[model samples]
Target: MSGGRFRPLAGVLAATAVALTGTRVSAIALPWYVLGTTGSAAWTGVVAFAEMVPYVLVKALTGPLVDRVGPRRISLAADVVSAVAAGAVVLLDALGALPLGALIALVVVIGAGRGPGDLAKEIMIPEAAGRAGMPLERATGLMGVTERLAQTVGPAAGGAVVGLFGALPSLGLSAVFFALGSMVVGLALPRGMGHSAPAPADKLGSGSGSGSAPEFGSGSGSESESGERVTPAPRRGAGSEEGYWRRFGEGMAFLRGEPLLLTVIAMVCVTNLLDAAFGQVLGPVWAKESGHGPVLLGLCGSVMGLTAVGGSLVAAAVAHRLPRRPVLFAAFLIAGPPRFLFLAFDLPVVAIVAVFAVGGFCGGFLNPILGAVSFERVPRHLLGRVGGLQTSLSHVGVPLGGLLAGAAVTVAGLAPVLLACGAAYVLALGLTGLRPEWREMDRLRARPATARPTADGPVSDGSSGAEGRVGVRE
Candidate 1:
């Protein structure tokens, strides 16, 4: 492990923050632009669906490819594609040549690129942490903090830019950010930052089998002999189509056996759906109806984001000492229903801001918990494919969210739809929070002892091999 210079970790965080900021900014600008131009809530939803459908689908399918090709190249290529796609939207709109079909198509390209790009960044975290000689918990906490900061600032900046200069400028700025993000990833990090060395031929079978080393916790600062920290470069022949499917299948099988992760995925899917509706359609519609326009939209988002950053910082300091289950349940309880109800009641802007800030604060801690669990439990080599699968599964409802909310608003009106969604959110949280499997969240075990590395990779003393082991705490 590298002594505490932490250079690669800093670069990874910077790149992720910049890229996510661009995406968040685009997220705000795009929907507002659609609503302003079309004056149809339904069309707004359609545009959102166009982007997210490709995002979820492509992300799901690209997991194995990310594992095979390496995250750095995929990340660079994805950001470049995103920049071009966003720039094209700006160019076409400026030329007055942007048809609805063309706009949607370009947005689709942006979403497609984002899927793999985001996954590639995520896959770099543990590797970066290991290289920096930092604990996984601290590294992931910092990662959560970086993301929250972007989320805090991005939408507000987008809204302000749209309010003062129009949406085109926001789109142009998104392209610039994406371009910058690509440069950071391509040039800022060291050569071997997240690269994997190929596995020795004789150890291939042992590395791929179920007996591979069981992941304990985030590693100590020392390099293990069994390849615990280093991902075994999949054998060269693993590039075949059959090999891809086999690896993909292994990822799925690994997920199936982990009940806690599945529970998280299911809960996240519903939450993501509701969030999509709120961010893309409901909030903007409410702002317009209230005669607040983009400035107030920016204000509300900024307040929420700033508070969320505070919450994330607090989590980084104290999360390990808190009770996981009750805290999470309470956070969800505070975060979800109130925002919808505030909108449903047509509360004052001040009231909305206050509620939103509180909700955002509670919401910030959730991701660190999720990231810690994932990083600690998942094997190093499987990070890309497994992270992709889990994220894709959790995002499955995102495309439907905007579409459903828009259609509902068009048919029944906004207040009723808001109330209905709020009620559903409460029920979903309640049901899942009370489930037996969810108890697992409260019971994650710390690493017992160090496992020695073998020729096959880091294997627990009693385990057969490292590749096949899926670490699930009761």
Candidate 2:
């Protein structure tokens, strides 16, 4: 069952890399197009708001869909939509027919696709790793690297491409990336590879044999058979379409039962909310107004990203040995508040860059650990549905963060806004730490029950069947 075809996996990876380029271009291109065409800074904000609203709204609804239908399908469909949207922009602009309303509509559509797109990519890594017989920890390490690089390079590349050749050309390039990404995902992935978490016989029939790992079950359907070895999945029996209310309830029920996972999700939501407020809106404004000018702003942004790269490198080296709880704790501690302080102080390039870099590094180190922790702690069956819900919740904060930051900056001084956000981050940390489940952060990493085998096949010396082990540490 573990015999995986590496060629297919390699193809997915290649597709992943190419498809990811559009993410970079979209980040810079969307804002440019909005601001340029609308000629209103306020409309720029509106466009961002419009885009993120659907991303959150749809993702919250689609978590179960991704779990049921399979990520491969979602990714394939999204890539097509993304390419069409970008192409449409190019087509409309070339003909001088692109209107602000149409542009906003497309941006929102792309944003919605992005929610599922990001989740599919993130979830696929572990599925492939499982197929290739790769360790989950190693897979997560690569996640950290990809995230750091994308966040770091994407913006600069987007800016440079847009600045030199204009938004349409850059957007055209984005269309190309999406087209390639779509083609590869649609054409290259080995059949049956995308079934990360098999649903019960009801919804998914049977997966192609990529069942959940150890602890989690997605609850789409669960019929346990004694002595069934938890390995790759089998094909599901059928697909039953249920009402949206029923599916949504099922997804929520799964999340509610997973307290440990729920905590992590909530924590992420809090952190993202605060960070988004500062990073996307306030920080940019501060940089523009701080006498740093565009060139210096770009330099500072680049430097900040590089810091994240360094942080990710350090995390990769030590993550397998680190306690999961502390990783979560320390990441938040380091990531929060510095942005507001940097703004309030209006420090020199050296000081601001140093602070931003530290913030970036902390952020880079944070997510993979959380992701590894989240995925590791749950039952395998729930990865997609749970991932969907979790991702939706985490992203919900983005728009809120932006809104909060905007209101704070408007009502209070920038310093107060940062402080308020910082305080919120701290509160989140404290609350998450209070939960008993967190104390077992490294419980899963403890020696497996068979570390000291008995007369039986394998049993824990000190723990019960499936008793928790040391976690976070591999």
Candidate 3:
């Protein structure tokens, strides 16, 4: 493959980085701003709930639309909306016309736009990887690295901006980042790179055994390893005769049958909730109560983010060779619980930073494994609906996490709430591991390379063989 083929992947990564960086910045800025202005942890949680609820709902409902309308268009539109909303917040605040209710409304708009925008970028990963001939694991790992880098940079910048220029400037910077992300997706990607994928007819129906669609790893028609001739489903979209409900139902049915996917989603729901609680409520509250403020909070996050980058790079390099189930289990063990415990104890700032660094490093291995597995199992065409549902479901608890944490802190005090959440994290992890479906993570690693009879002769889908592995080195 020529160097030019990698352009789509590069564009996606760039867009993801800047957009996520802006989000991370807002993560710090919004909570700090709310906490400082209102002096109420419950209000901070309410703001988080306002933003995330819309994000999850809109993302869940828009999967089929993404399939029909094309990811590129949806992504561009979402970012544009995000930019406008973020800018509006600062502008309204500057004019002394901003109210809490109005702030929540704007946050709702930003969240709604982020849902589809994030989904659009994600669904394009497989196509971009295929075009670049990069393996799924490596591609997702690089994506993780980009996210981690953004997390590092965004929080650090957010803290400094909030410290020196105040929260409004940080919000304005987020608007700039959103604009830049939009520009990258609109201009950097080639035509048709992020378009709706060709589907298999049986993808949405029960006719296909295992409900599996053909892998679009090559972004073109290819035979599967089972000697089955995999052909593209008829094109259906906004102009097509197919109705939206039918398309949506297909995705739902497909997701329902996947035991592994369901298991992953359930586990993620718990974790995302805990993470949101920590990031939005517990962390900031700790910062304020300790009198350390946003700078210390940002410093801890940046430390974690920096180490996570290193871990992601390592995962990208060697994840394909490692066992998925064990790595995932270990990652959670190292990454979860400890932060809460450290905070509950009110440890020295250096101790908190050190724990966060270690935890972030382990956490970095998660997305690459999960992303590769999800993409590899689902057919290319259903990426939008299926992936969207998966992500949306995983985030279901996010909105409530902050709300509950704030209420719990108010009633039980921060230390006890932190300890309770930490214990719950451990219990959730343990229970999730009891499921037998996790073995499939490693079992399916070589399934992509099975022999298939093509018109010429026997062939492979090029997933695991030398030809398929010839792309960029991790």
Candidate 4:
């Protein structure tokens, strides 16, 4: 925990925040730009769909590459590309040469870069935490806090910039943020920080009896921050050309074995789909139709972002103490339906923002729980590939959501679409609450980190009896 050890984390955290802020700014700017210029909800949706397709596709397929090339390199490169893409949009607009086709293409480039860039940063958190002598939960919480803060700052800033100057200026600022993010990564983080390989499987169990912290920069750890030892991971051979698919396959196989993880992944995927529809397309359409302008759009998001930041802070402080299953289910129940229903109604703008804020508050607890479980389950060495796949699955429905919602809004009115999606959100949450596998979330809270499993069940060594928590990538 020396100042020297803390430098990398500071850099990573700053880079993550800046990069996230840029993306969020662009998120608001791009959709608003399309809506303003074209005045067509469908085109806005098409642009959104175009961006997300590449985001999800490249993120899903490139996990092995991220693992092999290392997150630092990927993160730096991705940010640079993102900056260029944003600049392209702004430059085109300035030249009065912006077209739907050209805009979509540039946004696609932005998404492609963002996908790996985000995964790389997420992959670095545990590594940064371990090296800095911080607990994993606290580290992840800090990360959640950073994201929530960025969420608050990015949209509010994007909205203000768009409201004052225009969408073009906001896009231009996005490029500045991306470039700054790249600079932070390049200058601040040390080489080979996130690139170490895991100790062989046979070596993992040998350290079970010891209480020492895992060695920093080791790529994998035999111990978690909770003082429980990790289960002996079966090590794979070194990375090579032929090993890429095999590594990718390994990540898939790991996820398949963890049904609870898979369940969480599926649930988040559906919710992310719904959220994309609501945020990127539906929200903008509502703002336009209500004559609220881009300022209201930003204000509503800012309120939600602020409340979500509070929720995330609370979750970070006390997530380990909360009951995993019921708390998680309740958080989702509160978070999901309210915004849609509020938008569906003819309530005043104040009422609408309040509901969105409440939903954002409840939504904040989710990531801490999900992140804890993911880090505890997956060995660090495989985080890039495994995390990438998880991220990809979680976002798979995003493009479809935008596309379908756009078409639906074009065909049917916005009110009906809002009502239907709201009802669907309620139904999905209710169904998930009833699933038997959900009980596993609670069970995981009682298991130790070091507890390994055979094909049958967990290996019951006395060392794994310590407190447990769980996380997921979404």
Candidate 5:
């Protein structure tokens, strides 16, 4: 890894470690909290919906804010908020004042904070990864690994904390982690590092030699005619003080214009929605009802996390060698059905582990490949907006998934609900309609070695890009 990017890289993982600790603790608590409180499955669903709806909406809406503020600032602020929110939960629980309504509201607050926190953290990585000169695929693959590492370690840790101590301690533990993460990123980043734009002098010279300001819209630094140098923009990819809606439109238009990148996001949305139902809400209920306790649930989480790590390693090692479309399509194809079957059959420990492992493996493969596509397709000028939009779209299914599962569980039972979810995954993954548009994704992973990204940067791919041209994250 390039030394320049290492600090940022560490910042991201540290933030993740903090964030996931909170999520795992919360995840460990969700089903039990609801069941303990109301004793009604329907009410459990409502809480899930309440928590996820805000998370989804906040994530979708915050794209421009992230773009405007810079991911580093956003990331740092989010960590602090997450820490504070988690800390509040511990205090509330301790005072014998915790109620389901208060708990749900607090969760909503945490979820909202998590949305931007996650976006900022993910957006910051590409800049650092780019500086490292790591191949986009390798960088994204490692990102997938980082997520899996958190998933693998976090739940087990949360389980141990909750079991050995209680939810209050677990929440407090999460707070400490997030607080530390905030400190590291807020203080440790080299000032203005990974925020390069072309010097204005280079832009003027390059444009005068060829095109105009419209063509050189981004990378807007200027050298003074009188020999004084102007300061560069504080954040990379920010445009002139354009109207937020207009800027939002432009981001949307960018994604609409990119067919393959758009497809990847759509695929992610579908899978995310279904998985949200299967993995997020229903799965926990199933585990709890299956005569297995929180410890078993924790074991299940650990297995999935470990397998996801393996999958990330596999993708990192071999992804660049494969064609992008097929790799991506195959990953989605493998991810969905295993969970349904695993639960449908009520498999033994080894079997259950195998099912989750496969799901995690496929999920691990999905992120890097999808991330590579996202990072490569969008210009540096719109990274934050695109990243935010991608995240928003990817998470769109969550609330609905939780709601749908809530209703479905009452009618079809959890096993049948899972089976239905598996079908939904296959449908979404298959809808991309494999085409010539995304055929060369791997080949385009880096701007052709011969041609540098021009001062103006690359335009959307002529035909395909126009279709999915809105908010295509890079």
Candidate 6:
């Protein structure tokens, strides 16, 4: 592909990297800061709950708006909001005026902004992939690589900054990253990239087959090849409650029909919950209890992230050639259980590091496979709403994860809670795997279905009763 074609994808990836790095840094800095200051696990959990609840709720509600307004605009605007909120947290702390309630409120703002911002970036992925003539798996794999690289760098940097200068400085750096991410989306992307998805009635040609990118503006029209401006189809009840609910319902209905997607969401919800518990409560507590402190915590995360980057790079090269089901199953098996077990056992720092490294490598293969499947399944026009709903549902348990973990640890202590969580993780996956819908993971149609409106409802073209290929090579 020409550099022009690839530039949008590059910009999106760059923006995603910068933004995620900041998030990862905050992930470390905030929890450590809370734990250190309050010396209470329950309070730490409360802070996590405050942030993620708003994150899930806002992301769930913003899908239609993202579709109508354009992901690029939403992403840029959201990042700016995040920067300001994060900056406020740092500023308040510097002045020693930061109360617990104030900190929670600021993080809530940050989470609210992040919800749509992250969704917008994800909404751009398929379009970016098409622009570059890249396979979906490769594009998602590259995205995974970018995320892992941020994970690798962010934690280490956060730990160093916090250790050397304090949590305030690390938070200030996070604000800087958020600002940079906004700038990239604003200035680095091609002029015509990350536009709103066309309505069904618009009759615009689908996909990037013509090799023409969408114009970057938020206008309700695009210029056609004949140099005429093609107006968008009028949105029914646009900006009204009826329109938002209708769009939300459409996304929910689409999800309900896809048993495979539903099953994936169910499974992901459990894992995400467990992962949140680990990140927010169990991991930090373990670090403190084991006398490893923030430096060792960062070291473990860095080692895992580095290996995950390598794994993602390999996945980017060859994931399309792999069978989706077996790879996903194996990766989850390796990635989920052992980390908890090792930590629960209070193993030596070296042993914990090794386990994390191995687990992260396997974990890296996950997103590319799942992302490819999701992109292939959903129609392009509904990408924003569907993607947002899927993400929101999958994250439903995240807010509670920390609260549950913290309360469990406070009452029963850390090791027992860790063991129980690991057991629950295994159970959740094993139970979900038995469902017949999981077989669909390896079966995909040649292309995503195109939506066509009928008197009754929207229908998917070329998808009903079609035979599916066994792998994601297309």
Per-residue CA lDDT of model 3 for 78-166, tens digit only, reads 99999999999999999999999999999999999888887788677767876887764467667667767887888899988988888
Q: Residues 1-474, candidate 4, lDDT per residue (tens digit)?
A: 469887878888899989988987887898889988998888888998998898888887777887788779989999999999999999888898988889899989998998888778777776676678765556666766777777778888998999999889998999999999999999988887677654333222311122222332333345566656555443454564447788788767767766666777677667677778887888888888878877887777777767877887887778778887778778777777677777876789889878868877877777666655565456655666777777787677878877888899999989999999888877877876677776655555554555321110110000000001122122
- Residue 10 lDDT (model 1): 87
Q: How close is candidate 5 to the true structure, as a TM-score?
A: 0.81
**Which tens-of-lDDT digit does each residue in 320-373 have in candidate 1?**
678777877787777777888888886777897888788778876666555545
Model 4: runs farther than 4 Å from truth?
199-230, 233-237, 240-242, 451-474
Instruction: Judging by TM-score, tell me the better candidate of 5 and 6.
Output: 6
Off by over 4 Å in 5: 1-5, 130-138, 166-168, 191-240, 433-474
lDDT of each: 0.69, 0.56, 0.72, 0.71, 0.59, 0.71
Per-prediction TM-score = 0.85, 0.77, 0.86, 0.88, 0.81, 0.84
lDDT at residue 164 of model 5 (Cα atoms): 76
Clash totals for all candidate models: 12, 28, 1, 10, 18, 0
Off-target runs (Cα >4 Å) in candidate 6 are 131-137, 190-192, 196-242, 445-474
Q: Which candidate is the best by lDDT?
A: 3
Quick one: best TM-score, which candidate?
4
lDDT for position 203 in model 4:
22
Candidate scoring better on TM-score of 2 and 4: 4
Better of 3 and 4 by lDDT: 3
The weakest ten consecutive residues by lDDT in model 6 span 459-468
Residue-by-residue lDDT tens digits, candidate 5, 1-474: 546557666666676666655666566666555655576666677777777787767866777776666667777787788778778877887798888788778778777877777677666665665566654344545555666666677678776776677556766777777787788777666555334552222121110121111111333222344322232333434354766776677567666766665665666566666666664467667866786756666666767778867876877677767776776667656656666656766678788777667766765565555554544445445555665676677567666766777778877788777777777667766666455565646545432221111111111100000101121111
TM-score of 6: 0.84
For each candidate, C-alpha RMSD in Å? 8.1, 8.8, 7.5, 7.1, 7.8, 8.8
lDDT of 2 at 26: 64
The residue pairs in collision within model 6 are none
List model 6 lDDT by residue over 259-364, tens digit each.
7767777787777788788888888899889888878887787787888777767776777778777887787777777777779885777888888888778776
